[model samples]
Target: MSTAVDTGGASDLTLRKEAVTASADNAPTAPEPAVGATRKEPPPEKPSDTRRRSWVVASFWIIVLFLGLPIWWHTTSIYRANLPLDRMLEWSDGKACRPVFPLRISLDPGSLQDQEAENLLRLTQHALDDLNDFPAHHLRLQLAQKEAKQGSDVALTIRLTPGESVHTATSSLHPHLPILDVSYPPNSIPTPMSSSSGLATYIAAQLRSNFAEEQNIINYLLESSTAHQEQRSKSVSQDVAQTLSKRVTRSLKYARTYHLTFSLFTNGPSPSSWDIESAIDQYMRPVLDMLAPIHNFTLDTQVQLYAAPGVQSQVLSKEDLSAFINAAEWPLSPSIGGAPTVNFVVYIGNQTIGTEAAETSQSWLIPQWGSVYLLAPPSSVHVASDTLKQPILTFTSHLLSLLGTPQSGSLPLRLSTLTRVRSADLLLRASSSLGSLARLSLALKSISIPSSVADGVAKSMHHLELACASLGNPESLEHAQIAEAEAERAFFEKSMVGQLYFPDEHKIAVYLPLLGPVGVPLVMGLLNELKAWRNRRRQKAKAA
Candidate 1:
């Protein structure tokens, strides 16, 4: 602790210290270090700078999340409703349900004793079982519960009346019902305990003979389907098969309504009208009305004068038949609302065909669709209904075959078989359609399927289920029609497979414009920032 003392020196030294000016203003405002201080560490980075850099990265993320991604998703996304895709695939593959056909045959005890009727039913069933090779097409024989039920149960019933002969079989299929009259001697009736009898075999053989064509058709369709793998057999050869194939390929697929056009064509103005409406009403209406159970027919008649045949030569060749229709000039348009049209033309021509007049020259079937009848140029008087008797009769018979009616049966039996045939055809068609849809969906990955397609599939499946439940009945045909229509709708849904416009190159073109440029810069910026941060971290660690 030494005290300071001020001593006056020379006068000049004291005078120079009159006022001291402030030292030169600041060179940089820095904290002063103590004497002999070491170099000052650089100031730690400002927290604000770090915050600004983080905000830049965060802003980019916000733009991507709120704007860019939303726009991309909105533009590229497809509107696909939830479909039961697995179920559809399963159905197409025949994994969902196996279609089995069981026919219902009723046993009518109309006039026989209860014991005798029961015995006859059992014996007939046994014989039928022995004859049937396909278990899927089993015929179930149920006893009619009541007299009214008896009329409805069995497809056909035997009167079982006593007769002079040992056995006799007569069938009546007319304007009304399906009835088969079997008169056997009283002594030939089956005993209550017997499992087999001679009468049973006869009845079974007759029934088999009646439904043979229908059975063969069903077998053919089944063999064609993928539903059965090992059961297919070529029962008929190509020549015979060609004939049956023509029958199927030419015949119109079954429909609820058929349009029947009866036209009378004349080269000269001799026969203008043939009293067609009246003739059709008298001859054709009854059959059409009877067929109302399976199909509805709409009839329209026309008469055209100065109509020339497409062929002019006297003899018509096989090639001449196609041109004979004059399809380019004929007004035979298809009926609206999905029903197929059938054309029956009675051309009043003076010419004859094939040098022979008797060998189907007057009329010929147009494959499955219709028939063309060449009528003799009638007397030059106003055409009357009586002149059309032959043509109309021919037309009526042709209509049956065009509708795919079986060859060997009465009209009633044929019509019943038609219902069964139509149901089977539609069912198989629907199934095939489903398979095609599945294949189409799988093959074209980029194609879009609309919700309407799923809805149609659901409706089709529902109708198919209903149809399958009621097979071999008229109701089955109705259900099958619904199924077929819905399946077609599903298969051909307009929006389902949008024309595959966006190819791979198109997608690349679309994305490259926006994403390519924008993504590169953002990725570079992110990488640079990451590297800078990593370098800073390593430097800090080294210093520590």
Candidate 2:
């Protein structure tokens, strides 16, 4: 019975197992991966495709290299005109020009015979040559024509007259002309065979003395200059050098034209009108006319009432004098032209200058700027020419100082000396500017040198050459002015500074964005191509 029960149970369990097997067979089964069918290898790229890709990459690079790069370069490239750097440096170094001032002094035989005048001139020239310390500045004596013409190129004319009562030779300069009147006794007349003569010696001494201040000043300039330092004369004493330095510092820069603005500034509402026109016509016109050859002057006058000075001191110290010009309060605006403006102020105030502080009690000169006069309260509201006489005279004197005229010698002599001095100054200034430009070009490679700049430099050098050739001549001043102007224009070129303002960092900032994205893909593509080619080469070698 137990076996029957066990068989039934087993039969039931077998049926259950069959049922489980049938259910399992009927249920969804997972798909098996085919072992033999592996992933198929991709077909090798076609030669055409490879060629097409290469052409695409090459075209992109070609566009960038040939078209884009050229366009960028063309757009960004600086136009650098060639400059005569060596010649510029030569001029700056004084190697191109050694300025020699051959001052031509004409000797006029007034009462003496032609032969006697010639003998005296020869002996004087000899004496001058022996006494002259500076080789660059030389005085050349020449026989004047029987009739000396007006506006002759001669620096000065020495007229000789025999004085029956005179024991020795005596010289007197013409007050208004560049003529020296020499009176000598008949016995003092130099003979043709005589190596030395008292008259010649006296004349030589006079000439030397007359030109001594000019010589000293020029020597100081050369010594102060970087270019002519080696050629500077050692004869200039320290005191004289200091004095020259002071004068130079005080003097105005060279100009073709100067605007003279005469201003009357009063502390109170009085003296509004002045006879400045008549005063200038009387006291200043002659000097202006004299300077007309070297420089042109434009005169303008104005009156400002209730004007206060920067300093209110009654007795101004040296320091107070410097600060006396009330620049902000005064209507002393420069004249609207290319020429520099020189101011002459007559302040009708109760201010007095200290005796020790000022050279004069009436006025004080403002170096390179102008002059100021302190006038006591005038008797009338309208100042007359006679009342303005002393002040105008002071202004005239100050004008000479501002114009860089030498202190010694007559007005005409001083004016002539001014011409030569100005020529030298302009020459040196132009040369220095050229050197600065050359150095700038070499130092700043990115700077654009325009054709105009090159042209200016060329013009400057040409004028410099001409000026150097005719150093002591009146024409030299004109040439030097042109040279200085050209050099200044070249150095301070607007385009040069304009380009300089656009720096390299700014360029990179402008170009980087355009190049970065384009460059990355090009580089990656090139690298991929190289890797493919290398792999192909290795595979081919293995196959071989």
Candidate 3:
């Protein structure tokens, strides 16, 4: 009975186990967790940590914006001084100044009564006014006091004397002095009641003819300048304009002083020394003394032995003459002291000019530069003053030409005209220079302008004003020179040119290393902070 009971229990246990297995098979199983569905999430950042990170990014940017950028700007920024741009443009356009020359002509009536002289002067002035077409030039007649000496204000003196014939007048210019001698009949003088006089008309005509060349030259200058082209009256004919243009171009630029370098160049080594000093003293000193009122000259001489010219032919053609000066081999370095040098070369060679040019078959003027004279090979090793007379005379002529002395006037009158011309030239040159500086300042935004440039501009403008006011006087030349010098200084300032080479690429190259590493970390930190802030905002909105 025990064995049977144990068997029954075992069977029951087996049945129970099978039933558990069947129940396990029939019951639904929990689905396996999807990939990453049960992964452990990192802890949320603390509010303090997030705020600190944001503060760090803001601090970096604050330092860059407030401290670093300011420092960089202060260190690298160009200091540009303010300039008077409008005034400069106005001066260049010839709107600021219009030059007028009022020539004071003294009327010396040697034999006429005071009333007759006054009447005659009035009639003469009227005639001159009627005849003159150029408004820029004016001829004013003044009565000369017998007791008073000739004043510096007087440009020319007209001396009247009674001629043998009646109702006749003749005029002649004094060679040495600035005097116009007028020989007129006793009856030619105007009475106090008369409206006109034949002598007065004759005098007016003579004066007009005397100054016609100067008028034409001044007209040419006005027409040639870009600034004054519109202001010109176009009174000069085409042929006259061409001639005046040549003269203008051929003349040297005006300066306070001129250096005269007389050189003796020899093909052979025989003529070693010359009596240049003595020659110049004899033939050139008088002209220099006369020109002292207008220009001061400093003289020097040199002798170059065995110097070969650029041209080697025995006969030099007109073209060959142009290249005869051996610039590479010649010792024609300009003198120091900032004056233009006029070189007069006396070449001792057997070569002769083959062509019959009008200047000379033996010598030629180089136009604005100098002159050259070909001397037949000298007999002596040492040149005497007598041997150099011709060359010295030729040099004097060339010096006058180089100085732009008018061809039609007497020496004193020409010098006077030259003063006015030089003053006008300098005035225009300064105006043009100021214009260039203004345009340069506009075109080059990166260029650094210094306070010195502004100062120079101020000084130049001041002098320009003074020059314009004194255009007809000698003081005009002085004022114009100062203006020109200051303008040049302002235009050529060294500091302004340096900034042109420091380009944007150069600035990048200079600042890249300092800015790159520091900039990257700050930028990345700011971006991460911005992303975190955006995520937090989204989470808060979802929870709401």
Candidate 4:
């Protein structure tokens, strides 16, 4: 039966039925045919034409898989610029280099025969080798060719000048050069056959003692570089290592320039300013000029008035020392530039130091920055430039401690030790930075690594290699400083760490309208075809 609603008014409506009359033996069946309508049942439906629709749906997926997926991957994937991960890991692994400072000491025996000098050098070398427990830092003695007069023939030349004293060894450093004067007695030169000469043994022992600190510092750095499976050899025992690490920690990281800010802080307004410029020029300029080789220092001075310490009592307790500077109100902003800031503050206050309760004056080192000297100048008087004498001198001493100068040594020895310590400090700092970067890159798998960061790492590694090779030399400090700075730049790269957050709702909003209509038809067509195919498969199985 068919029912039709025809707007065109040409459709035919038809109904078909069969009538039956009762007969006792066999009922007669009658068919009421086309009196007013007709019956039409054409045929069972031909297999559906759904395969064409299915082909269209499959085509959409093929296009999406082959074309769309790749585009999305390219757009969303993080850009991981190629880093020399293996080499970087190798450097971190301590496998690429064994970090040895084989400082070559050239012997320049002005008038001695070559054979005699060679014999002495061999014997001294033998004695040094036997006495040396630290092989990483050693003095290799070699014959200096006269042509190296202009350049560094050796790290330090040990001149074997004949002296009038008894079998005694007197060592002296050349003020302007790296030469070490070793005066031996007139008759103590070793014969060619002797294995142990008194002079050779004496020289070896002296040289070893001279370089003991340098070796210890280098050893400390090597031990602390990276957390590897194997422990780095201990040239220094645990106690000495801990002490050296503390000293090095107090030292500022290597920098090309260090800004030295000297401030005069007064509790009241009486002594507002001092003649720091002239005083610095007189007392500190020469030293700064000399340090010009290793680090550039910029000097600035300020006078802060009406300041109060965190502890208002006349006596400052040990706990009150940290808060004494009044950092919140102080105008001690680091200088705007590339260099690190070293702040030296002269705190002019009536506050007495707890350590020196009897005397109401003292100062303290701020460790790696500068020192704070508390000076309560004469009451009812203004502090003139000359009044700052004691305070300035105190600041100078504290400045030495802040700048990583050793406790027990001459000024020259302290400065030299500062260089070696700074070098080691920077080396360890760089290594630690590299380890951090490796960990960060590993942790944030989605973050991008720019090529500039890779380049900086490579550059850092290069300088680190050079620094390690030239450890204990002036150039080692330069290289280590560069390496540490570069590593810091690479680790905290501004562009790399900026948070680029994109909300999920925003991504959904972006793609929903475009995907919705297309996806609906695709999904519906696939479902319809699947239902039809399943029905056909069921029919075929029943027939089988």
Which candidate, 1 or 4, has the higher TM-score? 1
**Between candidates 2 and 4, the lDDT winner:** 2
Q: Looking at model 1, report the run of 10 residues with the lowest lDDT sum.
A: 18-27
> How high is each candidate's TM-score?
0.83, 0.90, 0.88, 0.78
* lDDT score, candidate 2, position 435: 93
Look at candidate 1 and tell me the lDDT of residue 114. 91
Residue pair clashes in candidate 3: none
What 10-residue stretch in candidate 2 is worst by lDDT?
1-10
* lDDT values for all models: 0.74, 0.88, 0.88, 0.74
Q: For residues 146-224, could you state the per-residue lDDT of candidate 4 as single tens digits? A: 7767243256677778787985868776765556778888778888888789989998988887777766766667666
Q: Estimate, for each residue in 84-123, the C-alpha lDDT of model 2 and write its tens digit.
A: 9999999999899987899999888887787887888889
lDDT of 3 by residue, 222-269 (tens): 877778876566658889988988888899988889998999999888
Deviation (Å) of 84 in candidate 2:
1.5
Q: How many collisions per candidate?
A: 2, 0, 0, 0
Candidate 2 clash pair list: none
Any idea how many clashes model 1 has? 2
In model 2, which regions exceed 4 Å deviation? 1-41, 148-151, 164-167, 357-360, 501-506
